[model samples]
Target: MRFSRSRRAFLRAGVAGGAFLSLPASIYRTALGADVPPSEKVRLGFIGLGGQGTGNMNAFLKHSHATVAAVCDVDSSHLAKAAGVVEKATKKAPQAEKDFRKLLDTKDVDAVVVSTPDHWHALTTVAACAAGKDVYCEKPLTLVIGEGQAMVAAARKHGRIVQTGSQQRSDARFRQACELARNGALGKVHTVKVGLPGPNFKAPGVPDSTPPAELDYEFWLGPAPARPYNEKRVHYLFRFFWDYSGGQQTNFGAHHLDIAQWGLGMDESGPVSIEATAQFNKEKWFETPEVAKITYTYANGVKILCSLGKGGYPGGTTFEGDKGSIFVDRSKITATPPEILKSTGGDVKLYVSNNHHGNWLDCIKTRKLPICDVAIGHRSATVCHLGNIAVRTGRKIAWDPAKEQIVGDAEAAKMTTKEYRAPWKLA
Candidate 1:
């Protein structure tokens, strides 16, 4: 069914069996500016309270039109801490819950910012859409290629605005570079160079230990396999493990590769084939490649070479064409011969979002797709996941981007989606 109310209006209307938010309308009239329209204020739910979660939460809280309606985290302490932050800011306590499912079931939440690990992204987003909630989810959008597709389908099926948190997509410099490349300022782009963070074993690693009292390790694991508790495996360090994340190949690759896909005009499609090489630890300290060099070949013959570790092309994505090239990251964007960077004032259709969180909040009002929409994020994330698949299989796998499948090698195709543990169902 089509929606007239954006996610915010349905949230207020108690859509999907959710009750109306407890806060009075007068609460926001004073909490927000008098000049601001009442229809625009959105109460967002915060899920996951790790580093990225808290960072995104604070960023969204800065928006004058946005308020936190609820906060959820697997760890009790982190959940309480995030709730405290919200209460301190609004002088009102947002509902808190350990199970994210409970948070989604609430009508109080207009939209959800999902800052969970890669594995949780698809499930949470898909569930949120089914619940009629808009989503701002972190990248890489999913733990595997199929999950990205699933996310895109759910958002479209439910008419939900799902913005992937590839915030670099909203950066001015990145947009300029993509606009230039897209507008043909780069002149028939042939190759793109992508660089990702090299691997580093966190602090020599720690041994498996008892689960912390404040943490629900089982819930945190969720769909990921059950394993003994290890401090290194719990928080920031979880990226190195394949069960939760795809290492630098996906962590940083998700951002840079996304730029490569956007610049190459390949966000709706992906490479035809992938060939890669990687280094690994003998002791299996990590499941992902320690060092990897991946080559993704497009059906149109354009090539993107991504590297990590020593001799890897400098960090950031660089687009090279016959005329010139442009390289961009959060820090800076530089073009070859320097003068190519000065071109300006083009009528290119780059989604002009100066603020990432603001863009998501705006989309919740407009019923329009955000800068990095669900489909775009899925395609870009597929590019990163393809690199991992090629490394793991040690084979040159052919891909059919249109169908979102492995053309050959049934063995390789299995990596595209993961099997969730009991009590955590993607369906």
Candidate 2:
């Protein structure tokens, strides 16, 4: 079944910035009743208060050590909605700002949660790190490979805690699955299968139009190329476009593939080579592939076959070894031999993190790296990016995990980093 989308019409459909604050992390705190101490609290500022951002805010609200200090969003509506959530929970209104830089500059903010679109993730994270604030950035940690590198650099240089929001690392099922694969419970693992969901772009195409009053369209397009505002192109739907995100390849791939990297014990490194093929929507409804088969080869000869779409492998990560296989997703974990699932997981015990947000908060106090550190997120995202590069260029890409480069392919290498749209550069 070949899915084809017309490129000519879509190609004709469209045309189309901030500073760092240098300061020490804030120790400022407000009254948290008699139970919590002022010195033990982590004042959090939030940037990009959309669906994911709001979700993250609610999670942080559950912790007594975390206090919502401020919220920022390009959309005024989002800012208001987020503020309402914070106010209802804390019984106090958080400082709201249209610009993220102002949120970072606030003396009350010791850390920030960056749930912006993929293009804005790197910039927000690097800037927050430079401002002496810790960061919890959403998955697919960067827009490009180079951006991830820059984020890692800034985090290390500032001595800030930067956690990548690959929350699966905290899930018990995923932890057991990775432990089995790493501890030889799965015998010498040779193949790992990762499945991602198809794109969710169901809306019909709409013509480009004027920006809404509530949205700062220009500011929202920070670091991205110029383009007219289209209702379907902003907010949650931006994942379908190449200029903003790499579709489901990077969206869901970031989560599942990160688990694959963990199971393979390659958090600091990535596959040695990648090859992919994909099909796009026949109506040209969106730019990303509707279905794809990406093959990644690791240095140790472990093969990862990642399939996307309807007829692909079932949604989850499967590790196939000589003795048995372990399959895991958000729902449950299963092993081929049944008894493999009951194994004590040998001597290798992966990091135990029951709550993703809690781990970051604990690390913030201890000054230790969280479960999904910036570097791990970068390596996992590199795998997703390499798969996209292969699919986009229609060629096999040789990668160097140590040097973090695409070997022998100049064209593909260029896709690793994108040109910023004036003023907004990676920190």
Candidate 3:
């Protein structure tokens, strides 16, 4: 999509530093300067103030141009705490709400940052888009395959700019690593090993207890099937439950699998076939697999191996090619290929910011898609979800990316989209 003249001028001027002096102010005020006032604050609202959400909120607060205007959480305690934090950080008393819908209703909020759990992502995102608010949603994009497709459609349909929180795409080191692999620094790339931390597993114990009064347990369940609230089943541990999330396959896998696809130049598409085997404890409290190995074979014969294991490649990805291989995680990037370390005067597309939140803010004013657009995020997330589906169904599944469905297995295809609870349907 073509950016409006104001947005184009803002991007050109911001990046090039006064390069577009002749650009019209009308274009700037109408398009690029809509949310960001001349005083330089980008009014922001945050939803889901849990661990990850709080961290994301702080990251956005760190930007000089951003100001927290409102905060929302299902838990009243979290909502209050987040509002306090925002007030302390920005020195502006932000409004707080237990229901995220209220945050969306605020006209003072220019953009919405959704760091809600997996099940809540699609619903919140679709609502935000319908409200005419730009969105910065946390990664794995959607809980199910169809949700991602719906999100992409909603963003386009509403003309809202959306950024998926796959932060590695904005990291220079990761981008450099991907560019190196893409440009054949890793010659004849054969296999990519993407490793994620194992899933959550507790002993067979702990009867369901009463949920804390401060939290709206029913609202927290949202579109997920009704279930008793266990402390472990609600917040961060929601990743372990099949009904809420796809375990680490969607959690950490979202990050590593994305990089693997970037290196393979398969950001817009996915593997043609997926097959997986996993080890799970039926007797244990955990519903998701604790350890598993899933292999995805692409049309070009490139194989991506995702596994739950210890040591060497924790929370990172390893690219193996005919030339050599490289291991990259959040903290470091290393390569066995000596030439990769050596200077190469090759051109590469580098995102301007290393900070993920900053990149989103920049893109909002520029009206350009961020590094992790909905399409790219959805396709990469599909790799993770497909692996989980293959393991669960214990069969090789054929995928048609265009149609976004399993070829013949009706039962398996049914899992692609979930039934949202009453009023929380995806738009």
Instruction: Sort the predicted structures by TM-score, highest score first.
Output: 2, 1, 3
Which numbered prediction scores highest in lDDT against the true structure?
A: 2
Across 389-423, the per-residue lDDT of candidate 3 in tens digits comes to 99899999998764566888898888788898886
Candidate 2: give the clashing pairs: 4-282, 16-226, 16-227
The worst-scoring run of ten residues by lDDT in candidate 3 lies at 18-27
**Clash pairs (backbone) in predicted model 1:** none
lDDT of 2 by residue, 247-293 (tens): 99899999999999999988767899999999998888789999999
- Per-prediction TM-score to the true structure, in the order listed: 0.90, 0.92, 0.89
Of 2 and 3, the candidate ahead on lDDT is 2
Model 2: ten consecutive residues of lowest lDDT: 10-19
Q: How many clashing residue pairs, candidate 2?
A: 3
Stretches of candidate 3 exceeding 4 Å from the true structure: 1-39, 200-205, 310-314, 343-352
Instruction: Give me the displacement of residue 7 in model 1, in angstroms.
Output: 21
For model 2, the superposed segments whose C-alpha errors exceed 4 Å read 1-35
lDDT of 2 at 362: 69
